[model samples]
Target chain A: MIEVEQLSKVYGSTAAIQEVTFAVEPGEILGFLGPNGAGKTTTMRILTGYLPATSGTAKIAGFDVHENSMAVRQRIGYLPETPPLYPDMTVEGFLHFVARIKGVVAGDRAKQVENALTRCNLLEKRQVLIRKLSKGFKQRVGIAQAIVHDPPVIILDEPTVGLDPRQIIDVRNLIKSLAGDHTIILSTHILPEVSMTCSRVAIINRGRVVATNTPEQLMAELAGETGYELEVEGDIALAQARLAALPGVKTVEPIVDSVEGSGEPSRQKLRLSLVTGTDPGREIAAVVVNSGLGLYEMRRTRVSLEKVFLELTTEEKAIDPETMAAAYERASHRDTEPPILPISVTTDQTTDWAPDRTQSIKSDETPIEDETEASITAEQPSRPEEEP
Target chain B: MQSVQILFANLMAIYRRELQSYFASPFAYVIAGVFWLLSGFFFVAILLGPEGLIAQANFRDQLGMTNPPIDVAAQFVSFFLGTLSSLALFILPVLSMGLYAEERKRGTLELLATSPLTNWIVALGKLLGALTFFVTLLLPMLIYQTIALSAANPPAPFTGLLLGHLGLILLAAAVLSLGMFVSSLTDSTILAAILTFALVLFLWVVDLVGNSLVGPVGAGLKHISLIRNYTNFAQGVFDSSSLVVFLSYVMLGLFLTAQSIEAFRFQRS
Candidate 1:
């Protein structure tokens, strides 16, 4: 339903979105996740034909954004970060207006507006001035306007922003319900919304798509090398050395295990992150048994999307927000170290919060590389992004 | 057929909303009332004051002023129209506080930009909507002349009256469009209003300053003189060339409005 090919948008000397390329199929809900200021909104704007890309092409329903904007617009519905609503107009009046503007005919305009209002659960707020409505209601009105004409392609930017917990749930459920009826591409700072509402996830950072796959697929791809976290009763260094010597064990790290109580004779419990190309639980148990160490707890390390995302997007040494650009100059040295590829971005964690589209797992990536890299690299992983 | 239908739909949505806003606020009535009061004072000044000047010139004297054989009422309307045209520059920025600006301020303009309607179409509809309100305010004054004539002996020259009204409205519309263009430049209403008024006032006096110059430069200034063109129309002369000038001004305002909307797309990227 949507195709963005090497789409680039630039302002003066700065590039907002560079070489952004992605595609969404019909009836698919593609969550565009990114940190704030990531080019998610810019990409959506280009696809919706709101802005022309500086380079490359974006198409909706086979119509070019720049060349066939009129046709492209007609087939697509877009809800921007700020709902384009006239506060002076009432809910009913605004939707009716949007319906007309979206090309709903005079004969059925009222019905179309009514249907949209109903779908957004805004029937009672029809007579209320948009400015008078609460933020959530105003958002509902925004959604009403987008879907009033019932366009096949829907592009929503941060649909759940500024909502309280309940409202967030309500909007999320509403988005999920919209599946199959519309091809939805939504950009948001919220992570769980993608896992819950989007069928496929595209993580974008710094204007590039860094990852894309189903939520489950992403979790599995991130956890490609099966391994376990083993805590053993022995000297931390001894446990680490023992785990590192096991055959088929790709790598091992003695992660610091903090215990609340002290002054006891209890031996240190070393948190071991062991890399095995296959199931290594039995082999690890044999190693611990022969090493005369008491096996504390041994369990598989489950990698969640949260870990994958943070691991994928963190910039190791970000320029201090203080010195601004000057600090960025110093931050460049820290930019190169991370647990993942794009090894040189130690200082550019700026896009970690924004969906780094470039983080999408390559279908052709070697499984061996995925495991050995993430396991050994997690020891010196970059700090997780600060929540907004 | 579908796209055209969509364009028409969007235009009318903006049109109705704009027209409704004009009537909903006191802006139209307030501007017209103040203008009418000011025009009445100017009319009284030119007709009935200063007998010395009239006697010296062998002209008529009514109240305290000397008067040329100028249709004093038309001259009064013309002078007020000039000032009122300038008023549009002020009133419009406040009135057009929404077009693109409010949408931007509220983030709705992005939705509009992304909507099915083209940017130019949205802009033109909005421009026409604001000007329509301006025209509505002028209509009451147009009717005022009819009542004034009902009490007179020789009736008002119908053609000259129309020509004056047309010129007055076109000038006001042009001023409003220019103001709307300025309004589109920023999300700040106060800034738009102030800038628009400044530009209108500046352009209004551009001709006067230009004409007073020593030589050939003054001739060029006359071409840009907003007041000069209106003066000819107020005297009941309809010059197609001057009409073109005002038309060009309106077009220029619309073009700028369109460009500003498009520029946002780039900045956003």
Candidate 2:
């Protein structure tokens, strides 16, 4: 129940956010994904009525955020990047105070505060002073304050930052639990948080939304390639030739760094780039064994959401507005069902992959960074599938 | 009717929170203890010491040189209130310095700003909370003054005596309001306190500079001088204009604080 149209906030000369547009349906958790300083906080601040937009408009629950700020504010709960808390106050006291300010009825404030304490798992610590609590508990208190009034729309900015891994998972589960009855817009720089929690992901870079789609659709459409890297103990050239001859095996090339220049080493690494929607792992293994090559190791490699985020945010000139609109138009044309929302920006580089450019670029200089390649390949097994 | 009731409820919520913070912190108690010690010293030295007003009046009575009917009680009330006003100049800044600056530093201003409560309500609530604490600070001194004044040969006139104390409260309300405005301008409480002290000090003595000149400009400066209006108040002149000036200062401070907070929403940081 939020609509932002061409919202732009300019500070002196530099625009913090430019023509940023998006929408969230009722009960939908929209992940506002972006890197640091990518205007995620700026956009959220504008939506929360904390900062006024220079141009355009934002409406929450049908009330204009700028003109009808009080009404809009009454309908939404906001957790700033740094949770606004009074350290001297006890947890229950702070929530009671917040519930009052948020206009909850005096009769219901106690029950609402207790409800929030229970939901955030902060009941035991309600009597403790906020200053004495650890960081994770303080974060829970922050979340508790936001939800104490139980407003329909919640805007959380980086709710999981600075928490330990276990705390992050707990906070994510808490946010997920909040999604069915409350519409949530959670902004975070963490890739997996969005994938694990949000139903729809909007990738923003340089104060612009480059893509907005379901997390699965985003991964499947923009994920670079599904391929395999094999380390063989015999006849690397013969293994490459036999693998290349197989159908749907797009290309098989020897990994240069794994080769011994002076002599035929006992082991070599071979990389195979397969066409999309092709799984020839069994055929390739049989081909290697029948070709008198011993396959020591074969690892599946695909672009993870981290790579998709990097490709969206870090690529300096990959997406301009016109190309984004053209790409969105092309995507709409290719798919029969309309996009979930009015997607103003999206990428279509996947549908127009250039094979000649792949041939020109060597394996070592491939677009994927070495660290990302290793991490994605290592994490291939325990990939989080929708987090239940 | 319902809107006003809601407004009052919101205002009291903020006021209670502010008062609770003041009472819970050792720093406010430390300030109160120092105030009690200093004001107690002044009270004893001015009224009971060897070279004090009561001692001088006694010496005059023994000499039997009846120059005029000197009302020692009226003189003491006026003199003590003048001293208290100057004493308040220092303590009120410390009280008001953290009113908004602390909120800004801790990021709680975002909560207050984003909440449905109006800016003026928050300002007024905070001002009332601080003013209440300042009154509690004065209560012990007020108790001793009342006991001392009760023993006067002819009971001190309650009108002038109460008027002088009213002047003290108004002067405080004025100073605290302005200090709250200054606090909203910066996140540094120390800077807010120092600047507020500077501004109050300038307004306290503007009549001195006003006396050096001649014309409407001089009259205007002298008219707005806080010490002048406070003296009128302490002397029980019943000047409605002085009341307007003190009230105008309070309203001006509140108005400016509200405007500053409204402008803060558009500020870059």
Candidate 3:
């Protein structure tokens, strides 16, 4: 129902989206997944004929979006990020107005509006003014207006951003029911929303499509990169050595035991994580038991979609030396300003395992202040150390 | 035929919605009320004040110089319409400020642009809707004129009265069309209103600049001054040139507004 080919949009010098290509089958719901400012909305706007791409073309229902915008718009329904609602209008009034503008015949307008209201579960609130509706109902009204004319394609931008959990589920089920009749492309930053609601997922970042596949296929591809977590009471070194000796085992790393005050000196509890190409649970279990170690827990930790998402999005590579030096200089210059908070307070507030240099740097600054009253003393020497 | 029908349907849909929106808020009511109060004050003061035209006519008769037979009705209508034209300078901007600016601010312009309806349909619907409300605001003042004219021994010339009102309508249509164009240029309604006022004030006083100039430039400025064309109509003179001028201004404003909206669509694209 929708085909986008090498779509590129450049605003002045910055590319809002570049070479974005995706397709939605006649009955499929394609999840446009991306973080904020990742060009998802920009791509949707182009597809819906609300914006013109600087290069490339998009076809909807076999009509070019730019060349035949009116025809394309007639076949598509769009719910912009803010719902594009008139607060003074009642839900029914607004839907009827949209239906008319969308070119629904006068005879079918009322019936189509009623169908949309019922489908979105807005029949009860049809008579209520939209401004009086809650955020969730307002979102439902937005969806209702989109479907009022029964268009073949529906494009929604973050349709569930402000809804409650129950409303989200309701909306998800509503979108699910829309399949087989209407093709959908919904953009969202929520991972589970895509996993649960979309048939195929396209992950975009920095104006580029990085990955596109079914959720299951994406998970399966990353399955080999997953590791396992094991809890055992044994000689930690022997278990580590034995687990490393397994054929498929990549490496064995022992995790700290988090149990409090068990007071069993002879029995050392260790968590062993094994990075393997495949599930090595059976071989590792047999080895641990035969080696005379207590095997309290053994389970395969499957990789989740969240982990896959993070892996695909957050893998930063090497930077060139010139750019690296420029970044370092910028960081060092940023360090001269007085800290927004006291140094001791910031050091105490460290939630991560990184070192605290607040005290040592303060000690270093004390000598400089004493040596020369004319010298510009740094307010906190520790601040520079905090720069990466 | 079918395409024309669809276009009409779309225009009607937008027009109805816009008209309903105007009455749905207190903004329209406040504007109408202020307009009626100010226009009512001018109407009464012109007819009944001690120094008004009626009082001056009576004083002239007592002095035995009423041989030419002063036409109080004609003088009253002309002066009344003159006051209305001035009042339109202030009232029309308030009527038109929200036409496009409010839609842009509230983000509903996205819906309209992405719909199958064209930009001209949207702009015309809004213009007609505002014009209808302006007419409604003028309706009550018409009642005051009817009462005052009926009490006179000799009734006012109905043709002159009709011509005067037709002139007022044309002048108002011209002003509102320009104001609507200004509204389309910005999303800030206050900025639209203030900018429109400045532009209208400039045109209102363009004749002064024309008076200062010595040649064709002065003639051109005088021809374009909005008040110059309006004065002929207010005097019950059916000047085709003035009518053409007023129509030209209206068309110019409408054309610019449509282009402004089209430009906005291009910018968004």
Write out fnat for all predictions, comma-separated. 0.82, 0.67, 0.77
The models' CA-based lDDT, in order, is 0.67, 0.80, 0.76
Give the true-structure RMSD of model 1.
8.5
Ranking by lDDT: 2, 3, 1
Worst 10 residues of 1 chain A by lDDT: A339-348
Q: Encode model 3's per-residue lDDT on A1-388: one tens digit a residue.
A: 8999999999878998988888889989999876666799999989987788999989999999999999999999999999899988999999999999999998999899999999999989999989899999999999998899999999999988878667887998899899889999999865556767789988776687766787655544544444444556778788889888887776666544434314655454333334534556678778888888876544343222222243222212322334323322332232234311111111111111111111111111222232222112212232221111
1 against 3, candidate with superior lDDT = 3
Per-residue lDDT tens digits of candidate 1, residues A60-111?
8899989998788888888988888776788998888777777777889888
> Model 3: how far is A34 from its true place, Å?
0.5
What's the C-alpha lDDT at position A385 in model 2?
Answer: 19
Q: What DockQ was computed for model 1?
A: 0.61
lDDT of 3: 0.76
Candidate 1: global Cα-lDDT? Answer: 0.67
Candidate 1: Cα lDDT at A372: 34
Clashing residue pair totals per candidate (backbone < 3 A) = 43, 0, 0
**A-chain TM-score in candidate 3?**
0.66
Angstrom error of the Cα, residue A319, model 2: value is 23
Model 3 misplaced regions, further than 4 Å: A228-277, A281-305, A308-388
Model 2, chain B only, scores a TM-score of 0.98
